[model samples]
Target: MLTLTEKPRRSPKNEQLNSCASSFADYEDCIVGFMDDLQLVHCGHDKKCLGCGEELAHLTLRGVLRGSVGVIGESRLAMTEKVVLLGGRVCAVKRFRQVSSGRREFGKKIEHLARVSQKCEYLVPVAAYLYAKRIKQHGHTALDWNQRLTIIVQIARGIGFIHEQYPPYEKKMQMNVHGNIKVCNVMVNTDFSACLSGYGFTQLAEPVEVLNTGQLMKSPCRQQENTTYSDELSQKSDIYNFGVILLDILAGPKGLEMTKGVKEKKASMKLEGGLEFFEFYVKEGKERRQVSKVLEIALACISTKPDARPSIEEICFNIVEIL
Candidate 1:
């Protein structure tokens, strides 16, 4: 088995060599050549094992489970369902293809995710991740009340893990931002535990120019370009996205759409009787109060002022208290 470790930074000459490599075989040659020169640790073989040449090669493509669904969203990547044989077990894969650029950066993002996931179980475990002409993928596979409370708390813990960045994992700074967070990005395992997947892909992808739209939007606080808090991807922004996820959970699928329409209106205090629209759904007693508390936390998360939003730790605490 190939041991996965961080790749050494390429020298300018190596970069040029890599840029000139025309095919996957040529690129592998470049890497092998570099590794041989430095006597860098590698699978003990004169001819590098092509199967495990890349850091994530252990999860090799076993068979195509499904076909491509053309380019999707800002990632500008195609998706395919496939089956990968890893550790003698079959795992479902979500293969990705980047359009023109950012492949290297995306690979680093995956490396960072893989490292973090090793330490944080709340993150979606990467069975394998690789980058080439286009990125490829591999990996494996939640909800209710006491179930509702359990779901949100687990979600918060996952987000908090991303935010905290403790110890060895902190060596690589890029792992800090979960640039994309949404209902679709949050996956529930068969065991009902929530794990976050889509992380740095949004940042690597082509940036969308339009403001305040879509499932993942720029936090209102960072809308202005010149502000110190202008980075669209930040801990606070993750919190804001988490808030949206909470709202989506509270409201069903159709209700989530309605909530989005009302979001702008709600921010401006223009929604007729305020949050009563959401409150109307729950019974008027303790259930309404409990739901209202959760809503308040959600609203705080999506606050226009990033400073006003609670940290992930605080969000977790509040949710735990409510439960």
Candidate 2:
């Protein structure tokens, strides 16, 4: 229920946000090296970039999937892979759409977002260049493939980073709202570290197009235009989106039924009784109740009253306290 009169921005220089201890200090040097090392080769623009026109030798921590299957709003989001420096300590990458026409403008935003990403762990940085690769669908894993503990901790830390913002960047930009957030957008590294990805649903200077799935996919954060809530694109909205993701993680694949059951009431329960569901199905024990609390938080975030929603700072504090 706690709220803020104004949004709290992330501090760029905070040690937690800028864990990247690389010797490269100047932003330009870091970007230049990252791009050069990528050595991108352009394959033709196909849903799946099968033929690598000029394939790079190795995959950097992040790059674009030639034709990734992503959906946004009513449109299937089309994205190009981009690798970004994270906290200066880790490398995080995801598919993104460039926002500007000219390289200069594009460079500026990428630099800005990179610094912002460094400052605020919640928002991802824009990449200097994009590398596209073919994507092959992987079969579903065994049911025994439970969540990795390290990945869970990484997600907690990543969300924690978003909650705590650093200094100068904090003073300049308002709290960033990740307009569209979902499980598909979040990535877990081989080491089980998680990073927030996909900022295309946010402020973009160019035309917005969803990745073409050729079929409609539900977008959790779509808002009607010219509404009383013109500020629907605020940071609180991102919080709501993040809540959905948290539910996805906590509920796992079967968790979708919980949501559906809530809606339909007639839907079959994952367990025979509510008590059994709470006792056995929910893994985190006491934390399972917290999912509903988090759901309530998401509800507040998406409330018609913009003023009613808690700021990122408040949400962070509450979540940390609860955890």
Candidate 3:
């Protein structure tokens, strides 16, 4: 129900205005969509913000999100009745904080993964730039447990691309892990293909300048510096997490059983005195072998020692080859 004037006042968000200008130059139509936090309306077609007059609209929200998408930590996922520019098919819009460095480097990482996508056939690759959300809430929510009842999370070809493009040595040594691979961080296309989405957790052990000491300190950015090696992250970490994701997609303890496991683990992690379920997978004898090869892979990747794991490339190759 928003109104537009005859003379067309300068928009506060130029991207929205420019998109409308490009699409409906002669039509002079006032687009009706949700405004972002910056009070800019994203037209979605060309991303021209109708509030400000800027020609930067590559990353803007179109409308309120629908379907089983929601926030998982700092990320947001939602299915919308809009089309992504890459393939122009109706796709779910996902938003998360860009990698710690900046958007340009992150975009380059996506581009690098896309450039060699043909080599890998098992993973999905992201196809656009990462940008701040233009729309505040577009009414999006996380996927409910009952909604994804089948536990069938779709992984895209991007992982395969990463696995394939990496040199065998790097693959064996450390194919560059998907540091925080999880169900919420993956994307599914119309074709049921799955792709990795969150790379913000990926980090390198870099030196930081200590102002007081005037010396460089090596800082490995994993949670508590729990890295594979001296400031190095390996693909095995990704392999391990991916295996967990596969477990979630395949079994995931479903229903009341899922809730029960959750409560128990929550208590255990908090030292509130509960059964240590994480140790359940480490049982010896034939019982251990009965726990599904997939689960075993997950446990192995999550082992305390970095050197005691298989690389992501090897893991992906094994999954595609074995199962």
Candidate 4:
């Protein structure tokens, strides 16, 4: 398998892991704006923001699994909705399980991750996370198909952005690759665009919460029924993760089973076999062809051989072609 030494075909600019974006809020739009706009531009952060100066406090949380669930190494997780008093934007605050690190360490890590992740749009910039132990419960579709296309494409671009990062980033942040790329980690906006979250903190941040909006319900990137998280990860693993997400998009209720079948040699990764599951989404013959192409792309992503797996850059280009 080719290691970190391999260069991307995306171009000389991608060599530096650059793409168009002045800020993280505008990243989804930036994905649409460029592949041509590949240049590592520094995203500016507020120098005096309180979030940037984090202070950690330990919480002995015994979570109620009814409204939320996730394994955070020691404890269970619960979900609560948060409203930013300043902007009135609804944000979900899910309290995490057992934390092994000191409060100060956790705070520093969040600040560091936020500061470094600003270089790109697809890799979501941290929007001030609060470590409130959730004492309460928590909280798409397109016009319709176009939004589906938009969300997936943005996710692909985001993953592609991660794959193209310079080595210095991984050294600085401790995680350059997205260790977890599950359905819940991809946040959809009110505008139907999407961004990848839960990155860089394979060891620290337990993505116990899922940010929801109208686009999430019908969006292909809905939360998985039996979600799993891991820390021992790689770029190829990310391809597999993304493939499973694509499978979920196409197969819905049968996604997990189909993924198992494909992995365990029980299922065929043929277009005809996959098409039956997603038939409702394809209205016209052209749309069917696009879906077919996407299914193939997903299969390639989950290929068993590490070398056989397509890079995120390749996947992004192919997905863009389908759109």
- Displacement of the residue 120 alpha carbon in candidate 4, Å: 2.6
Regions of model 1 farther than 4 Å from truth: 1-80, 84-89, 99-109, 128-144, 166-173, 203-231, 253-287
Best by the lDDT measure: 4
lDDT of 2 at 146: 34
Q: Which scores greater on lDDT, model 1 or model 3?
A: 1
Candidates ranked by lDDT, best first? Answer: 4, 1, 2, 3
- The prediction achieving the highest TM-score against the true structure is 4
lDDT of the candidates, in the order given: 0.48, 0.37, 0.35, 0.51
- What is the alpha-carbon lDDT for the whole of candidate 3? 0.35
Candidate 2 least-lDDT 10 residues: 130-139
Candidate 3 regions exceeding 4 Å error are 1-73, 76-99, 102-110, 117-121, 128-160, 164-175, 189-192, 199-232, 253-291, 313-323
Residues 116-159, model 4: lDDT tens digits: 56666656665443332210011121235566667678888888
Which residue pairs collide, candidate 4? 18-39, 18-40, 140-214, 140-215
TM-score of each: 0.55, 0.48, 0.40, 0.59
lDDT of 3 by residue, 1-323 (tens): 01112223456666333221111122123334435422323323244322233343333332222122222222111111122323232232333222233434444444454434323433332333222221111111233322222122223234444554445333122344444555545554333334455442343112222222101111111111222222235455555555545444434323122434544454343342212433222334332333334344555555567678766555555445423
Instruction: Give residue 83's error in model 3 in angstroms.
Output: 8.4
Model 1 CA lDDT for position 54? 41
Candidate 1 lDDT, 1-323, residue by residue in tens: 11112123357765433221121221233244343222222222232332243433332211121212121222222222223332333332333333223545445555555556657666665542222111001111013334455557777888888787754234234466777666655655444556666555554444324433433222221221222122377888888877776665665433334655655565443223234445233454555556667867887887789999999888888777766
Show where candidate 4 strays beyond 4 Å. Answer: 1-44, 47-94, 128-143, 168-173, 205-231, 259-275
